[model samples]
Target: MEVLGRDRGSVMSVAASGISATSFASINAAGKVTLWDVRLQHKDCMSVTTDINMLSGAEATDLLLAADMHVAVALAGGAIIAYDLRQQGVLSVYNHTCDNEAFLAGTHPPAEQTTLIADENGAIMPFDLKQCRPTAHLSDRFFGTSTTISATSFGALSNICCGLGFIRPEGEKPLLCAMGMDGSGALYTDPQLTPSGFSLLQESDLVEASGKVLNPPLPISASFLEGYVAIGRANGMYSIAVPVANSTLFEVLAAPGHACNGLSVLEWTRGDRPRLLTCSVCGVVSLWDVMPLVLETPEGDEVIDEDLPSLDVAESVRDAVGQQVSVNCGAVIGDNLLVVGDAMGFITSCLLV
Candidate 1:
């Protein structure tokens, strides 16, 4: 396996480009976005950096793969920016001025043209990429759902989206899926019913299990499996289920795990069953297979580390690519090819057996 590496800043997130499978992008805490081409030995193809001071802990960024090779980044400065990948630079640094809170998360499904940008306080705004501005929010239409309530009223993990996806509602467009603090996931979006935009679809109001409070959903990836988002349960359990959905689609029952710092969906291994991986601080990776996971998909898919090996990541990385640092985020190229960003601002791509 050929392991190749490159250093940028410190990547906070990395995902495959919606436009190209061999291409991906990574963003650092300081709002530096670096584009990489896996075909070029994982070399840095292009990059854009904001003027934020890296140590100030302000003006942070989260990414959404917008349409037409454009990446949307949410900033703590209450503004959203769009970068045109084809031009190898930013198209709109201030695409939209949002609410007064930090924009925490964003998601744009491949089928949709609008991107849902959520704030730290949970209020979500739909930005029409074609129009380049914030569209009507679901709350403006007076829709009532657990997700909207969580966002407005601040209900634990409900508003701070770790991941975003959609469910195929019986409408022209699918319902937007978001998590509720409890297991009662919520879905929104109905064209005929609510012409203005969306409505309260449904909330999965689940009770506490065994009297044990369920951990809030952590960082998530919507690309691992169709119709599902892999969540790192705050309890360190890895789950391959739609976030806050009524049912737990899949969870690997196993020993308790380290607090998952990150979770990325990697179905790159040549097989029918795609895999979900979780990494803790310094990049401790654990893998799970879904074919063995059942249909009713049990709960407590522990996102633990004991089941997997947390070998010294820095040393392992040094041996693999000669650069030793904690892994920040990752992206997969082809079947068996792995690419990751490290604490030292390095991006590495290699074939992992």
Candidate 2:
């Protein structure tokens, strides 16, 4: 595997453009967003700094690249800013009147136009990209009356809320996955629900591999791959089947001594079977060949679960950067390029064989 490294100064988040796999966008702790052409030796194409005051410790927390050549940045001070990459300036800035900090921002399936912004209070706001304003507040849809309680109570419910992904079933409307801390999660499937209102299809509680209730599993990252959602927690990882009547736990992969902070599905090697890449807070990166539990249907019969396969721990690389620097996030760009971002603001590109 070919490896390349570049230090961009304390990167908070990194995202590759969907239109161009070699193009990447990253936001730093100083509120500076830089666009890079990784194919050209990680050249900086453009840079833009947000207007958030550094004195207030407000920085760009999360970023999302829209298909319209616009990047949406979620700020730590409860604001969302849409920046036009072509113009190299801010398209619009939106404040949701929320006192909590923003955690992550993403788009739902189907249209993939409206930007969903999740905050620390487990509130999600659907912002219209065309109008550059929030269409509705959706805290009640995900967390119910948990938002109306005290900060301590809300904090006990979950640490933060982040948009996982959109699940599209065969004959139903698309549902949005909102994963929170302490294994608190919800799936919203009602089409009539809007920024003005919201509804949910299911709510799930946290459970261990032994089916015991737990307080703080701390789901840090999640990704949807091969009809399943893999949630990386502080303790381990859980794979859940999508579009079910309730949240069905498929399998639990233990992490032992690592706190899973980043996860990405690598579509390499296997034709239809994809590999899972997980990064830990302890500066360890491991690849796993996950054989998901299969289901089968006989002639004119109901579907039943087949034999479950074990998770194989494949190749691993420890401290890809140096000692003790945590790998924050990573993505598999192009065909075989594995790009990882670290706490020290370095991006390492590895060409997997």
Candidate 3:
């Protein structure tokens, strides 16, 4: 394991390109984004600074690799900037009028050109890369005409929308999962942009509500792994079946004791079995064997088996710096290298055992 130190500020976000895993992007608390080439001994290949005055007290929230050698940054002020590595300056910047802070930004997996940005109000907007503008607001498109309007709208309804992920099931259209600030979540499938309609799935509809107001699990991050949506929450980690039907609630997974702040799903094959790499706020990194259990009922519906086998934590690594810093984000680069960003302004690269 190798630890890299940064003196600028806390590393807020990290993203690795699908086209070239050796290249990765990271944003710091000071709104400085840097692209690094891990193959070149983690050298800073490029760097840029966003408008700090326009941030309005908000930090850089998310970073993503939109295309080959292209990086997109989502600011807390709802500004999305696309940067090309070959270019000297930013390629383009799209500004959206968001009442709340932006939380996450990503591109649709199937259509890599379509960019999606999620905010604190639970609003998800789809942006066209070519046009450099938002295509539609997902909440308005999905449930604008419903009688129970507010319930369908994620706008400041709960704490905030913390995480978002796209799942592509075999022989089916892509599905989008939005994890609310609290434990509540929702799913959208077969989304249409023209008419703006989709099949919706809500957590309230699947699980019986417990009216207790104690400390509910707050999802901090999420990802699609091994045909399931893995959610990293304050209490523990949980996984729900993708393309969620009416039967499955999030199944809890035994994880680190502290809050799970970030997660990265790497495709790994261990004797035909799938696995994943998970990291937590307390700087606990673990490897798990993924085995999803699904049973076909007589009613011609699929349901997750109650006695699903628990994921085994095959390996674990604690804090490399030993300063008790939170791992804000992480990504897997190359074959077996794991790079992570911490709240203490340190980027560490680990060679998996």
Candidate 4:
């Protein structure tokens, strides 16, 4: 795979194809779009200039891995836009502003084209990227009364948030979890109910313990899996797994993960096995073995470093592409490339070879 960075600009968001595994795209602080042809050898593909001026003072917040040639980007101003690479860097698609567009997830089956956006306002807006209009909006009274929305995802089904608004991956139906600013979180399923499936609301939905003031980090971001959810706080990381029954298993501190600026989940190993990766504002990256951890309890949980090689460890490490700074946002590109963007507008591609 090829890693490219403009002379001075840092990338805002990066996304790649989970199917082809050889294509990727990124948007920079300058609002330029760079589409890479990973199938080719050495510095492949050209950079396309997107005249799409970012809303003034807005920064790129999050990115969604959607249809091939199409990438969804969330702006700091709470707006979301889908960029079509086939149109040569044209951000022809746009959506309305809401609470921070922390996460976006698309639908499956008949409505695979539908996408969901979760914001800080505790509102989950479902937008038909194909039709360009919102179809539905769901909000939990408990969440409205308690937490402020943070990160969100559809993979966990609908939108998932930590400390509130944690979206989970797809299943028989959509599931959503909200993390309260106070350190408690609640999980809900089938959000589109008449009275809102209050019975299905997972009891003791509260996650991570919080005091008057949380240490490390608050629930700034979260990542979702089929039955598991990973949350990034100022202090560390936590994972929660919900079973068919009321078997809610969780990790209070899944390793001393960093104060996350942003995070993403990658389904690799031929899509059979998955890994949990967390990126911090300090530019440190950690990859956890979800397989081994599941096979045993925390007391028996194997040390992550002993199980796998640490990518950020070593002397041969290449200095980050642009500057010596923290990576505020990160997304997995295919299975091998990691694209990191920092506050200073510096974006770099790290090879996971």
lDDT of each: 0.47, 0.52, 0.55, 0.47
The lDDT leader among the candidates is 3
Structural similarity to truth (TM-score) of each candidate: 0.63, 0.70, 0.72, 0.66
lDDT of 2 by residue, 39-139 (tens): 67546667887555632346666666663446545455656667777777777776655544433322222234554566566665555665667654334
Off by over 4 Å in 4: 1-3, 40-57, 69-78, 89-97, 105-111, 137-174, 178-186, 194-214, 236-249, 258-270, 298-318, 344-346, 351-353
The residue-level lDDT of candidate 4 at 12 comes to 64
lDDT of 1 at 8: 52
Could you give candidate 1's per-residue lDDT for residues 215-304 as a string of tens digits?
434334333344454455444545444323332233343333344443332232334545544444444454445434423345545444
Q: List the residue pairs that clash in candidate 3.
A: 160-181
Comparing 2 and 3 on TM-score, the stronger one:
3
Q: State the local distance difference test value for candidate 2.
A: 0.52
Best-matching candidate per TM-score:
3
